[model samples]
Target: MKKIYYSLLLTLCVGVSGFSYALQDAKNIMESVKYRDQGVDRYSDVDLIQTMSDGFVRSRSLKMYEKEFGEERKGLLYFTEPSNTAGTGLLMYSYAEVDNKEDDQWLYLPALRKVKRIATNSKEGPFLGTDFSFADIERMRIADYVYTLKEEKENISIIEAKTENGLENPRTGYSQRIVHVDTDKNIIIKDEIFRQGRLIKVFEVVQLEKVNGFWTVVEAKMDNLVEGGSTRLIRKNTQYNQKLKDGLFNQRTLRKGLD
Candidate 1:
């Protein structure tokens, strides 16, 4: 009778521990989404125009200077033109939280006068030349993805954020990502990419100094362990909640500037 009682107690304890862990995982995932959503919402508010503008300026100015073979480098060699870049440009979009959609466009080939619409399916591809993918631009609601609490220890909740079609690959198909959420900041501080349940890539982000009172991503790096190559992206300007002009996002505006 004593042995039976002890066995039951142990089983009960295990079940309770599992239940607690599941609940905590749910909470951690929820918190991660909440924090990201709040930050994005705040970023869209018009009240942060000044900060946004500052970030824009700094981001545009971020560049690496390199001397040419014959010393021809002089001005604006490292910084991209934004309009002519292959995968990057000034993002002009309107966020629709109520509808869970984003109306966004990109301006490329300024010399030819072209503006292209951003498709929902292509959100997972890299943004411009940076390591950031288009999905990184818009914010998603917390309830959109299914959450699994993978681990919990040392006051840190380990969550895996998985959504059906979470990552869209234009050329291939969809990809799955397991993100490690930082409970303290409610941010997805790290991620491991898997394709068909096989490890493929690892992504990391480092928080830098605040720009315009908003927590900004200072350095981001993505490694394709299988490909033997990596990309590093760094952002200097990060401003939130600024008034944006309607025409500024237009293709014509991209060619004409803020005139």
Candidate 2:
């Protein structure tokens, strides 16, 4: 009996140690992805296509600008196509200081001719009638989640993440996310979003290439499982580390449209 008891205890110890190491490895991988240096500024023209359940498709075009300021990142997006959405714009500022402060977001509606601040409670709403939420477009902070390695394949590592450190918004759409990371490149290739323990959406990186020494996703798709629809975002004419004006990301620029 003594010999059998010792063997079981030894096995349990090894299992626990392996689990701890896996968790640490998953966190390290996520940190690499979150902190990867893209560039100081980036500009891109994007095509947004939304496919409906009844086989209808709508398309729009957007001009996007991004810049890094200290630890904060600013983004501006302006619609350029579909006449009706031509002047619609969104401005966002993501802060590195995580002290219970939410990110800043603003929307400019051409019909209203005004800029409206997006409240934290409404960040979970679909972005411009697309499959992506406002929160999805913002930068993700590493400290906001606890990650564990679920599985590791030869080319990919699957990590399950749960919100921590008061990072989850009460009104957010997703409760947890399962991410498939490219082990070699340390980039997120796919994500499964769960809402109340039910899988609601799947996001996939369909194409990726290195742009100015940074890995960039050129084509991506988001499928809404419950809604029976999908949205595809394709990037073209991408330029990185450009000299974008600081004033372009402000609300004034959003309302006026990029000069």
Candidate 3:
């Protein structure tokens, strides 16, 4: 069996991205965020710092790479720091909203010596004992939720969306997400996730940069409201269009890791 004790040390999320457009309805704004141009290929060194409710802290390092194939986006990550967590990797493939396709994900746990596919129905679980869930890491489906333009506050557009089937949907446990989008850049700068009318998680961008003409998230934080802890994802040496090889995104890479 896989190492249950180390499962929390074996995973991570990719970039949360978006683009620019004229102000319109909620769907239009979200569409812009979902379809933003990231880049042809990219790479970065990432740090995941977690602060527990009891005041303990843990930090992990990762090598992250992303690339675009037509309209689909693929990303790969390899954990490289903290001896016990090294060699852990995650691979993801996200598609356009128009295709109505489900994004795919796989996690390689070094202890298990196997790459496990993340099922669509199990995306709600937390990542690396952090506040961010697998669903938060995956590409957001425009069809899965119905959005409404709640209000406009200065440069931020406050919008809310509810899962189509609500509580009955096994695909995601969170029934609602209230997103704060940058009105000018058309990107999600913050998000508050809710379950059964209770606020449980909050994600906010700590820093951003225009790298190689592409908007990139330099740092972000996910706070677990219910759990009283937080995770800060800090990106360093972020670069766009590295012409990353196709070999980096497959399951084989997950097992071998990014060298």
Residue-level lDDT tens digits of model 1 in 28-117: 566554444322222210000011212332123323211111211111112243334422234445343455554454535445666566
> Clash pairs of candidate 1?
43-241, 48-241, 49-242, 87-128, 88-128
Model 3 off-target regions past 4 Å?
A: 1-24
Residue range 1-259, candidate 2, lDDT tens digits: 9999999999999999999999899999998887678789999999999999888999999999999988788999999999999999999988875565678899999999989998878988999898888878877766657889999889899999877642454546566889999978878999998877789899999999988888899999999898889999999989998999898888888767776
Question: What's the C-alpha lDDT at position 70 in model 1?
Answer: 22
Give the alpha carbon lDDT tens digit for every residue of 136-191 in model 3: 87777777777877888898989888876666245667888999999677789999
lDDT of 2: 0.87
Better of 2 and 3 by TM-score: 2
Runs of candidate 2 exceeding 4 Å displacement: 1-14, 97-100, 164-171
Candidate 2: residue 229 lDDT (0-100)? 94
Worst 10 residues of 1 by lDDT: 44-53
- Scored by lDDT, model 1 comes in at 0.49
lDDT of 2 at 202: 93
TM-score of 3: 0.87
Q: Rank the candidate models, highest TM-score first.
A: 2, 3, 1
Candidate 2 differs from the real structure by a C-alpha RMSD in angstroms, to one decimal, of 2.4
The lDDT per prediction is 0.49, 0.87, 0.83
